[model samples]
Structures are given as C-alpha cells and as structure tokens.
Target chain A: MLENFKFVLSHTTHPGNIGASARALKVMGLSQLALVNPSNFPSAQATERASRADDILASAQVFVTVEEAVADCRLVVGTSARTRTLPSQLVTPRELVELILQQPARVPVAILFGTENSGLTNDELHMCNYHVCIPTNPEYSSLNLASAVQLIAYELRLGFAQTPELPEQRILDNEQPISREQLSGLLEHFDEAMRKTGYLKQNHEKQIDIRMNRLFSKANLTHSEMNILRGFLRSVLYRCQ
Target chain B: MLENFKFVLSHTTHPGNIGASARALKVMGLSQLALVNPSNFPSAQATERASRADDILASAQVFVTVEEAVADCRLVVGTSARTRTLPSQLVTPRELVELILQQPARVPVAILFGTENSGLTNDELHMCNYHVCIPTNPEYSSLNLASAVQLIAYELRLGFAQTPELPEQRILDNEQPISREQLSGLLEHFDEAMRKTGYLKQNHEKQIDIRMNRLFSKANLTHSEMNILRGFLRSVLYRCQ
Candidate 1:
C-alpha cells in the first residue's frame, strides 16, 4: 500500500524541507515523491539535509503544477491545517490509513502538501477527494512542512503492519476511479461545451471550473463513467456548432 | 498526560538536531527537554533550526551524563535503533505509550535518545526500564534524530486522549459557510444559466442539476463566494438573452 502512494510537495520555498521530506518518506519505506514548483532544487543544503537518502531526491519527479504532479494518481488527498468552510472529507492520519484500507481500488494515491507558509491553496485543496489534518497543539500548531510529512509517513508505517495483502484482484480495473489526468480532460470538455453554449463567461470560468472539479472528485467517476460524460459534452458542443 | 513526560537527549552531536528535536517536541505538545553533554550548546545553528521552538531550547536542562539527565524521573525509557545483546523490556513507541498509561506512578517519565552517530551506549541503555524502538525500513533505517523525536512525539499525542486543552482554532466570521437556503438559490441560478446555454437538454437536465448541486454542496461556498457564482451566472444569462 505504501508503494502505491506518492507524497507531493507543492511550492516548497525551502530546499531543506524538500530534502527532509525525501528522508521522511525513505525512512518509512516509501520511495515515490513528487515536487511541484519548488523554489529551489538540486541545492547543496537539500542534499545535506537529505542525509543518506539522496536516491529519493535523485529520482524525485518535478511538475509545474499540482495537477500534473498527481495526474496519474487515482486518490488525491490534501494535507490542510485549517478546517475550511468548504471542507473535503476531513480525516486524521490514522483515519486516512483506515480509509485507504477500505478501498483497494483507490490505488496510486497522491498525498499533497502545500507550501511552507500557506498550506494547500484553496484551488489545490479543491482538487482533493479528502483532506487530512494532523492534530497539533491548537495553541502552537506551527508544524514544519517536513515534520508534517514525517508524522503522516510514520502513521502509514505503523498502520499497515508489514504490508498486508490487499484484495486488488477482487476489484475490477474499470471500477477504479479515473485518473486525475483523465478527470482533467473530462472537466476541460465540459468547459468547452459550456463555453460554446454561452453559459460560461470570462469571470465565471474559473469558479465554474473549480466547482466542477470539486463535484467530479466527490462523484469518483470511473473510466466508463468518464467516457459517458465526455460523450455527453461532445454532443452538446456539436449541437452548438 | 504529556506534561508528566520529558524527553532526554544523550550525547547529541549536531546542534541542529537538538534545535529540531525542540521543535518536534513542542509541536507535539511536549515541553520538557533535557540534554546530556551535547557537543555544542547556545549555537546559532540550533536556534535557526529550532525555528520558533527556541522557548523549549531556552528552558532545556543540560547535564553531564544521561544518569543525571533522567535522575528525577520515575520511569526512564531509552530509545535505541539496534537490538542489543541484552535488551531490556523492548517495546515499540506505541507500546511505550501503553506502558506509561498502565502505570500512573510513572509520572515525570523521561524518554532518552542517544548520539547521532552511535545510538545509546550499553551503559545508557542499561539505565532504562524500557527500550522503545521506532520501526523503520530495514534496508534504510537511518531515521534522523529529530524525526525520531517527531515520531515518538506523534505516538504520545495519539495514545493520550486527554490532551491538555490548548486554545481553540479561531475561525473568522466571514469564513463560515453559506446556509442551505443560499445553496439552493445558487444551484437554481446555475440551472437557469445552463438552460440558457442550451447545454442542459430535457433528457440530461436532471443529471446536470444533481451534479451541480453536489458540486456546490461540497464547495461549501461562503456568502461572498455564493454571490460571486450567482453574479457570474447572471452575467452569462444576460449575454444569452
């Protein structure tokens, strides 16, 4: 289960956090990591902080956007400190592990973390199916970004108990939710179709797009269902033409 | 429960690790820290790495030996990475927490961590009533000292339920989500806009409406956000007319 998950750090300002995050993942037996728009990479400070876990950093994937970073992941989770007015499925680290165990189809999970100063942006948080909040001292909730990763990784290590055999064979491939990339395509199709019909205005496009993304994430559309939505949007666009 | 426990670092080499350990403890609501014969103290690097956890560092008690560092504690637990020839009451971090809870007499418990290079010397390990080990990747078990502190701190946080009440998180007034009545209005506005766009056919209108509702409900839009979406829809409708 740890093998199928990737930790994505978005807009990390400090090089040390990136390196420390790599070590955190490695120590917990997790290898996959993705970095989005880091302020600095390939820095000596990062290498030093990573200690002996250079391999993780060497193989780390970098993306310009969080969307691209987690495009292939079926389950997208965001780590947030604040309980937003518009919240996703909020879970503790332990609860998150239980949630993962309950569903074998939600493989290749992406656990997203935001920048050091401000956690996952509203737009970024909107993209996730669930929001994981590490309970901290409410008075002094100033948790470091890498420390946050360490706690989450530690929970993953403790909760799994030697990687129990998941019932993956029981869940059909088509039953799995569509990948983030596929979902993005479906959202784009809807945007184009709505635009052609004159329902989407310049100012409202972003809000509509975000809302659709949030909605579809909750819907957890599978590949076949995504195809159906795409077909419907294509017909609408054709009708407008 | 956390107030009754103190973390002691024996022979810590890196000052940065000391600072980070302070941060790790403070984040998990642990305040008492004792250092035994650290290579460097009152160092700038430690302060920098401690981030805002300098208060813990400031109040940290330093001693010449691990014996002195934990002399006041009733239950002394040492953290060890390796399984020594003569292990004493070996337990995982989780188990250590359980052990602490079982015996309330173990108040003012001291948990010891050893040097960065060579974890707790045999003499140091012999002094402890229990050895708490954090399980890491066997192939690469080079867990950072501060990270180890973080992991242990996290377990303590989870194992204890009556965490001392820190101040409650302050949620701004405007950040509160819009009422359900407002949500219904927003969904109606979206339906009107979609109908005007000709994207919502009679056959697909119901599906579109439900999807929009689901999306908005998840969005948990605030009053201002609701107005933004409503305004955008009104603009689209005006254009269509």
Candidate 2:
C-alpha cells in the first residue's frame, strides 16, 4: 500500500518543511517522496530537519511540473484549506482514507501540495482527480505546509495500520443470584435497626425504604456483597437490641 | 461563543510557533492562553514572533502539568497527529467547531497542544474527550504545532462567528421551588438524621456535605424536583419519629 502511494511537494519554499515532511512520511511507514521544483531541494536545513529520514530524501524524485510529477499515477489528490476554482470532488481526510483503501492496490496514487505562500494553483488543482480540504479556523486558516502533511500522513497510517479484531467479552460466571426474598429480609432488618436508633419515624419509613432501594440498586450488589451487607445488618440489629 | 473560547498552547518548545499560535488564537477571537512546561516562555523571541498580538502572551497561564492548566474547563480537546493508546473520539477540525458552538457559555472549553518534537502523549490524550486531526500531504505531512492550532482555531471561529439562537430551556414556572436557604436547611436536617443513624460517624461529614452540594448543584434541580426530594426527606424524618 505504501509503495503505491507517492507524496509530491510542489515548489516548497521552506527547506525545513521539506525535511519535516520526510520524517512525517517515514513515521507513517511511507517512503515514496516526489519534489516538484523545490526552491531549496538539496539544502543543509532540509537534511537537518529530515533527522534520520534521509533515505526518503536521497530517493526523492524531482519534477518540473505538477502534471509531470503525477503523470504516471492512476489517482491524484490535492490538499487545500477551502474549495478552489477547479471542480474536483472535495473530501475530508477521513473520507479520503476510505477512498484510498477502496482503490486497486496496483494503481499509483499521488498527493500534491502547493507552494508556501499560496496553495495549489487553479490549473494545478484541476490536474488532480479530487480535492482534500482540512477544516480549519476560518478567521486564521494559515495551516503551515508540513503540519498539513502530518495530518494526512497520520490518517493514512491509521487507515493502513494492522487492525486486530477485538476479542469477545467473556460472559460473567454466576456463582449465585440474590433472591427477592433475601433482599426483602435484609430491608426489614435494616428498617428495624433504623427504628431502634430513631433514624426513621412512621411517616419517613416508606421514603427511607425507597432511598435505600435506590442506593442498593445503584451499588448492583452481587450475591456475596448481599451476604456481607446482611451480616453487617445482623450485627447492627444485635447492637440495637 | 468564539469570543468566549480560549486557545491554550501548553509547553510549546519553539518560540516562533508560540508567537504564531498567539496570532492564530487572536484572529479567531480566542484570548485565553495556558502554557504547561514551556521551554522558553516569556522569551523575547516569542514576543517578537507574536507581532502585535501581545495580549495572548500576557494573560497566558503557565503550569507544570496539562491538568493544572485545564482544571476548571468542563470540556478538553487534544490535537494529535497519531492515535494514542488511550481511547478517544477522533474528529476533524470542522466537526470540533460544531461541538464547541453547541456547548453552554457557562462551560469553559480547553484545546491542548503538546511539545513540538512529540505531540500530546497517551496520558495527555486520555485527558481529552475529543481529538482533532488536520489533513495534509501524505509524503511530507510534518505539520508545525502552531499550524495545527491555527486550523482548529479557524474552525472554531467559523463555527461560532454567527449569532447563535438562544438555547431553549424547559420551563416549569408553575412549580414552587425550594430556595437556597431551604436546600441548606434540608441538607442540615439530613446530616442530623445521618448522625443519629451513625452513618456520618466514620466519614468526613464536611467533605461529604460539600460533595453532595456540588452534585445537587450540577443536577440543577427544578422546583418540582426540590419538592419531591424534600417530601421524601420529610417522610423519612416522620417515620424515624
């Protein structure tokens, strides 16, 4: 899947972004990188930024135009903050992943990024099969080139990452079930103890019983928990007597 | 809603990104800034990068951990390039805008950004209920931290920029509700009853009382709801007598 997809940077002005892009792609298990006339292709800054991902840099293909870069690719995607003058289909990064996954594995896919100052030109955008827009703050939608790359790469990685099917949850082993009779008996014992301590008057007994039931229901007392509670109630009754 | 939202940049490493993020937040009408474990906060380099937007830097909260910075916020959203080990609902920046817009004005929402080298850790991501991913180039998708902030902030601004219709609240004007004094009195009565039953003996009554108050306040009991509770309590007291 990684071999079929190629990342193309068109006229990237910053050497740092180019280098950072390499690192981002490598982290996501992608290696193919195509440069379309980068301003500073073989710069020390890009190499420094690439960190340990220089292999992507060494094998990077340099292209003269966006069309030439993506000419051989069966699929082409362009990234933008908003819709362009071109009439290409728009998809979010998440949707794009689904689209990418459904495509034939043999076909080469090309993702194009534009220059730093302005994004892909209208003609450049028209060359792509679809447009991918990253939703951003309308007021300040100045997403840096490399950050955009990272998000897309992250999505691709997530889409292609080996997903193990979750194991089914084990059914609870029922040792014993708390019977209604036992519950009623426990409630009666609690009420008698409360009466001895003047915790409940005649008018309040029903309300107290309701509250107690609510509390017990929330606790989800198992058989063992009910037994423990009953034992505690017996001790209270003994003290009251 | 946009005006009320605060963009907090926590523990940012690069001074330039800090400055850029400040600009991003200000443009989106989000003013609050919180910095956790920043490498060089209040640095001249950051101030220079901030350009004319100094207010974001001035009011920024500095903290040692992400928790301290976002303690008061009811909702927290973390930005990440990769999915963390912890479970979190992933959303695109656009969807996040809609979520933020729907929140009550009383609740403060926090957006967290991690260090430049590594995005938010798994632990940090766990703190957030939602994660925002910005789409970018697959081959060179290394997004700057500030740019990620910019995209999210931009989405938030767009979502909240419009005049919001008033939230429709269910009204029960006919019901006679308990006042704050009445509620306190009821709580005191309950505490007295609990003491008589020995339920309050081992527990820190003051702390429990405070927690109960918080829980009740969060419930936003209507007049009818208060009446029902009071009626139940009265019945309990009557039964005890």
Candidate 1 Cα outliers beyond 4 Å, as residue runs: A82-86, B161-241
- Candidate 2 lDDT (Cα, whole model)? 0.66
Best by lDDT: 1
lDDT by residue for model 1 (A1-241), tens: 6788899999999999999999999988999989999999978989999989999999999999999999999889999655544445678888899988886787799999999987988899889988788877666777889889988888888777487677546655655578999988888886776676566755567766776677677567776556545554555555566
Error of 2 at B210 (Å): 20
Candidate 2 lDDT, B13-97, residue by residue in tens: 8887787678667655677878888888788877875656677888877888876776666567788655433234457677776
Q: Write the per-residue lDDT of candidate 2 for residues A149-179, one digit (tens) a residue.
A: 7667766766765532121223233214457
Candidate 2 Cα deviation (angstroms), residue A17: 1.5
For candidate 2 chain A, the 10 contiguous residues with the lowest summed lDDT are A163-172
Candidate no. 2 TM-score:
0.58
**Top candidate, metric DockQ:** 1
Task: Output the worst ten-in-a-row residue range by lDDT, candidate 2 chain B.
Answer: B213-222
